[model samples]
Target: MTYTAMKTLSVDYRLERWTGTAWVTFKMSSNNATNTNLLNATSDWTVMPGYYYRVTSIHTAYDGSTTETSKHVSGTVLF
Candidate 1:
């Protein structure tokens, strides 16, 4: 089975993945005032017939500039 998740964040903000004890960072940019930007993360897994995996954490940042905004959400996966 495969697991896929997508997240969108505004200008100056970013998303980072946790590698057990540390974080791998990814950056995003927005050039339009009204455009929605997105960030995506994916993972693959194989399990028993009744198994599942979960997304544990999401990290968000907003670059304290006066011209941009940001938002975030986190959840689990069921298959």
Candidate 2:
């Protein structure tokens, strides 16, 4: 997924089981007058049976000079 913003920026993601573990992949890039940014990530998430999973806003921001912020979340599913 790709996001482009002149003001506020946001992203949404979902990782579902394929074979063994669900692999979540994401990337973000921007070219603005103020700065240029690049980011990438990959993870294998496992979900058990008879359970639910929910993950909220994972955010990342990078300026040409530095990585500003990054966040992640993981939740269990309940049947």
Candidate 3:
């Protein structure tokens, strides 16, 4: 038996650029998230054409049963 399950969410955004070797991570988030100006409005990083970038959303959920689950966006960016 379980008493109650509590849920919490913390959402953050990031825009990463490919440096030919590795993918760098940057802090990215917007109060009004849009596709028109996703990086321009939300991130401090600049957008470059022909460069691979990845937008990852990490999710973590926990309940009162001491069971926790975490999920991450998969796949690579091909620019």
Number of the predicted model whose lDDT against the real structure is largest: 3
What lDDT would candidate 2 get against the real structure? 0.41
Candidate 1 vs 3: which has more lDDT: 3
Q: Rate the local accuracy (lDDT) of all candidates.
A: 0.35, 0.41, 0.50
Q: Using TM-score as the measure, which candidate wins?
A: 3
Q: Work out the TM-score per prediction.
A: 0.26, 0.31, 0.49
Model 3 reaches what TM-score against the true structure? 0.49
Model 2 CA lDDT for position 58: 54
What is the overall TM-score of model 2 with all chains considered together? 0.31
Question: How displaced is residue 63 in candidate 3, in Å?
Answer: 2.6
Off by over 4 Å in 3: 1-5, 30-46, 65-67
1-79 in candidate 1: lDDT tens per residue?
0122213232333344444566444333332222233444444434333323333333332333332333543443334
Off by over 4 Å in 2: 1-36, 62-79
